[model samples]
Target: MNNPAPASPSPASEYGARARAWDWRRALAPTGNVGDAVFRAALFGCALLLLLIVVAMFVEIGSNARLSISRFGLPFLAGREWNPVRGEFGALPFVYGTVVSSLLALALAVPVSLGIAVFLVEQAPRALARLLAFLVELLAAIPSVVYGLWGIFVLAPFLREHVEPPLQKALGWLPFFQGTVTGIGLLTGGVILAIMVTPIVTAVVRDVLAAVPVSQREAALALGATKWETTRVVLANGAPGIAGAIILGLGRAVGETMAVTMVIGNRPEISASLFQPSYTIASVIANEFTEATGDLYLSALVELGLVLFLVTFVVNGAARLLVWSVTRGTSGVARA
Candidate 1:
């Protein structure tokens, strides 16, 4: 032992050993920096401010709608007649129109959006994908009023003359297709909404699909999967994100005002035919808010706003949950 003096550990070797034993948990442990604490507090305050703003909006709308809420109670939602002259108001038609139009838009937009997203993410050349993606996003940048104007001038006439007549001849027996083929009606509104929401949905879905790990695609392909099969695997993995995109598009359709108001014919009547004129909650609010002379009329309109607000809130919340669920599930799977 006296004959042997152990050589001092080299600096490089010591550092290498320390690095090998390093724990991420210990590395990330709080150092109690004042700057970090301040930054965290600022972020929390910003988040809280958003919540406060949402709460404030709800409270304000509810207070304004109190008159109609108290007078009509639950029946306001169910009442079919909307007569302001006689002081009779019902939200059923607006609710129906909003639901039907939004759903119709989803039905029309989702397939097309998904196809575009898939092509952009997986099939198209890089240059072509970028061009198409830019064009698609450009659609979203156009003003809503501009869409309304185009709908009124172009889409409405085309549908009324060319599309509706053929559909009526082919599907006349169906209640949805049976009606006067007016360009400015529920169907037109739905088409306009589809166009408006398409860009949003496509962009989101493209991002989501792109976010799928390349290894996942490679793994599927290496396992004898065809290109389409590989694509399907990617789609399955990105399902939650795709769902969130669609829901977000639905929210956009639900809250759209100017364009819907312009094309939806603004009639507060419920007919089985999509060709018939209709009014949505947002459209009705936009149309009548300025014209509401009576307190009850104003309150009824405010209540409609509240209804739209609640619907949008629920849709977005569901989308968030769907996204979160998939994220958590993926993380858990990775850990296992």
Candidate 2:
């Protein structure tokens, strides 16, 4: 029994095999044209340039700070005294102030930002949302100097006269509320930072919440969830993005200089009370850079800048990762 002649490949199979082979060939091939090669090279160059700039900044600052780093070593981080006269320096107080003020700003801003974002994304009418969003964005564009001026002239007095008095009267037993209510201190600086940070957090959170699939809201409502419950579901789904937004805002508050410098009283001392004056790394650098008379003093200031740079870089990197994760997750859900 002679075997029948093998059947010819079907058209669909032939086409599929050709497509697969083409794909493999394309994958294995070198650059197909000069344009493609040039584009790839340009993109790589841009990325390399950015990396080089960051490395250069780090090296320059480190070299400038070498004297202080050599003299103080690890103790410089925890040293409490920052006496330029005696060539003594410590970063602890500045670090403490930065942490406390930034935390206070986050505390005051996060709730307000969340509320505004939720309302704009879910509850407000289109026209109203547009108007409110524009106003919120406008706040971010206002110069830091302008905010500093407002903090000095308006917010500080208001707090000293009204808010701080009530806070002290109600919570005076707490060390945080026991100091004299100075118009310029950590509290004032925090409030100014809160005002600056709220706009950014709100904008980012509003976008993140809006990006949640509409199907999610519909499903929750289909299950007999109330409006607030539906909103809560959306918020839960977008939690990562919200966290990223908050971290981004914290980074902003951390690097803030002019506004904080103007109102933070510029005192390099650690204190338990928010009403007491304090200094942040940025504030101290701005106040003393030009006035640094000794080499050690200048080197110490450069070291402080390096610290700020590292902190900001790390915070921003974490924020970017969180934001990217949420964005990718949301896209996957939408596609599904």
Per-residue C-alpha lDDT of model 2 across residues 157-206, encoded as one tens digit per residue: 99899899999999999999887888889999999999999999998888
| Collision pairs in model 1 | none
Regions of candidate 1 where Cα sits further than 4 Å from its true position: 1-46, 324-336
- Highest TM-score: give the candidate number: 2
Reference-based TM-score of each model = 0.84, 0.87
On residues 1-336, what C-alpha lDDT tens digit does candidate 1 reach at each position? Answer: 156535533556555655676644334323334565567667778999999999999999999999999999989999999999999999999999999999999999999999999999999999999999889989999999999999999999999999999999999999999977888899999999999999988977787787788999999999999999999999999899889889989999999999999999999999989999999999999998999998999999999999999999999788766655454433322110
The TM-score between candidate 1 and the true structure equals 0.84
- In model 2, which residue pairs have backbone atoms overlapping below 3 Å? none
